[model samples]
Each structure stands twice: as structure tokens, then as C-alpha cells.
Target: MSWVILIVSGVLEAVWATALGKSEGFTKLWPTVILGVALVASMGGLALAMRDISTGTAYAVWVGIGAALTVAYAMIFGGEPTSIVKVLLLLGLVGCVVGLKLVDTSH
Candidate 1:
């Protein structure tokens, strides 16, 4: 349950991150509002997940998911380059997140 919340929070983080880029210094009213709402929701979800998960573990998972998803989203929707290196990096990030979860669960 906590992991689910953490994952949702990570997704929200990705959403807001993309929104922030589109916001263009907050000049775009709709994007700016979306970004702000997403940011708050992400943080609130993180706080809820932290009640059950360790801070370090939750934070690492959140950031790893956010970064990997953000890059993937940019590549697919934001016209960013999706080179072999980028794919490899994303895989590496996934591995790191999995490793953390394994170690955390074992403890």
C-alpha cells in the first residue's frame, strides 16, 4: 500500500515536472496551475507513504521513478532524443530502484 502510494507520488512528480517545463516561467496560466496542483499532490502522497516506509527508501524510490519516467515522457512527448544511451541509463535507474526495494524489504 505504501509502495503504491509512493509510485503514485512519483508519477505525480513526473506530471508536475513536465508541466513546469511547459509553464515557461509560469507565464502560461493553465500549465502553471496544473504544475502547482501536481506538486502539492505529489508531496502529500509522499508524506502519506513516509508514514509506513523509511524516509531514505521512500525518497530514493520516489526520485528514481520520477527521473526515469520524466526522461521517458520527454522522449516520447517532448521531442527529446531517445538514444541508446538514454535507454541504458533508464534501465540502470530501474535497476537501482529495484535494488533499493530488495534491500529494504529484506531488512
Candidate 2:
């Protein structure tokens, strides 16, 4: 359950990241609001998960998931250039994140 919460928080990190980009320095009302909400929720979830998971492992997994999803979202919708190399890198990030989960000893 902690892992599940952590994963969701990671995804929310992506949401907040995207929202922040869309906020145009917080000038946009909706995106700014979304960013605030998502940011708080994501952090809250991360804190909750940290109660069960080691801090280092939880943080690494959270960051890994967020970073991978953020780049993927940008490539797909934010006019970011996409290439074979970028796709491969994202795959690698995901692989590393999965590796962390598999090797976690606190379960």
C-alpha cells in the first residue's frame, strides 16, 4: 500500500510539473491552481509513503517516475522534439525505476 501511494504520488509529480510549465509563471489561473493542488497532494503522498519505505529508496523512485513521465509528456504534447535516442533514454529511466522496485529489501 505504501508503494502504491508512492507510485501515485510520483504520477502526481508529473501532473504538477506539467501544470507548472503551463502556468506561465503563475499568470494563468487554472494551471496555477492545478499546480498548487497537485503539488500539495503529491508531497503529501510522498510523506505518507516515506513512513514505510526507506527515505533514499522512496525519493529515488519518486524522482525517477516523475522525471520519466515528465519527459514523455513533453515529447508527446509540449512541442518537444522526439527522437529514437530520447525514447530509448526514457525506456532506460523506466527500467531503472523498475529495477529499484525489484531490489527493494524493505518489503
Candidate 3:
């Protein structure tokens, strides 16, 4: 399913984002490689999903999922500060992503 691929790509967006951070401006070899691979895969998946989903909806959902997961990952394991407001905002983003899915008219 395109939606499934889109979701996976969204998660990969988080993976590539985290890898890019670890790449340290591409100074690190392994992290840089990971970033390259994840970036391509994520973009490819997004393109595939776009075949079925509207461009705007797909892009918004993809970005929303990626952003929420990225912040969550940073807060949980990267020693980033966490707060109730941050959590609530992330939840709101997720809710909006789901709402987009629910209202999508195209299959």
C-alpha cells in the first residue's frame, strides 16, 4: 500500500535526520553513509506514495510524522530537554496527521 510505504518513509525521515546529526557535517563515515542511504530511500518512498495520495496531503503527513518522531527521538535518547508542552504539541501534530488520513478522499 502507498500509505504503508509513506508511513515507512516518514519513519525513515526520522532515521535520516538522526543520522545527519550524527554525521557531524558529514565528517563521520558510517553516519554519513547511513544518511545518504536513508535519504534516498525516504525520498523514493515518498515519490511512490505520491502516486496514490494527493501531493499536499502526502507531503504534510510525511513531514508531520517525520518531525514528531524526530523530536521524540531527540528528547528520549539525545539528552534534549523534554516538557509537557512539547509532548502535547507533538501529540497535536500526530492528531493532525491522522486527521489528514481520515479525510483523504482518494484511494
Candidate 4:
């Protein structure tokens, strides 16, 4: 359950990150609202997950998921450049996240 929440929080991180980019320094109304909401939700979920998961592992996983998704989103829709190296790097981040989960002995 905590893992689930953590994963969701990580996704929310991506949501907030993307929304922030669209917020235009908080001048935009809708995107700013979305960013605020998603930021709070993501942090809340992260805090909840930390009740069960180790801080370091949880943080790493959260960052990994958020970063990978954010870059993927940008590349896919926001005119960010794409290349094999970027893909491989994202894959490596995912691999590290998975490895952390596998090696985690605590619940």
C-alpha cells in the first residue's frame, strides 16, 4: 500500500513538474492551480509512504520516477529533443529504481 502511494506520488511529481513549466512563473491561472494542487498531493503521498519506506530509498525512487516521466513527457509533447542516449539514460534510471525496490529488505 505504501509502495502504491509512493508510486502515485512519484507520478504526481511529474504532473506538478509539467504543470509548473506551463505555469509561466505563476502568471498563468489554471496551470498555477494545477501545480499547487499536484505539489501538495505529491508531497503528502510521499510523506505517507515514508511511514513504511526508508527515507533514502523512497526519495531516490520518487526522484527517479518523476524525472523519467517528466523528461519523457517533454520529449513526447513539449518539443524536447530525443535521442538514443536520453532513452538509455531514462532506462537506466528506471533500472536503478527497480533495483532499489528489489534490494529493499524492509517493508
Candidate 2 per-residue lDDT, tens place, 43-69, comes to 999999999889998999999999999
RMSD of 1: 1.5
Give all candidates' CA lDDT scores. Answer: 0.92, 0.94, 0.97, 0.97
| TM-score attained by model 1 | 0.93
Candidate 1 lDDT over 14-90, as tens digits, reads 99999999999999999999999999999999999989889999999999999899999999988999999999989
C-alpha RMSD by candidate, in order = 1.5, 0.7, 0.5, 0.5
Q: lDDT for model 4, on a 0 to 1 scale?
A: 0.97
Better of 2 and 3 by TM-score: 3
Clashes of each: 0, 0, 0, 0
TM-scores, in order shown? 0.93, 0.97, 0.99, 0.98
lDDT tens readout by residue for model 3, 6-83: 999999999999999999999999999999999999999999999999999999999999999999999999998999
The 10-residue segment of model 3 with minimum total lDDT is 30-39
Rank list by lDDT: 3, 4, 2, 1
- Candidate 3 error regions (>4 Å): none
How much is 29 displaced in model 3, in angstroms? 0.8
lDDT of 1: 0.92
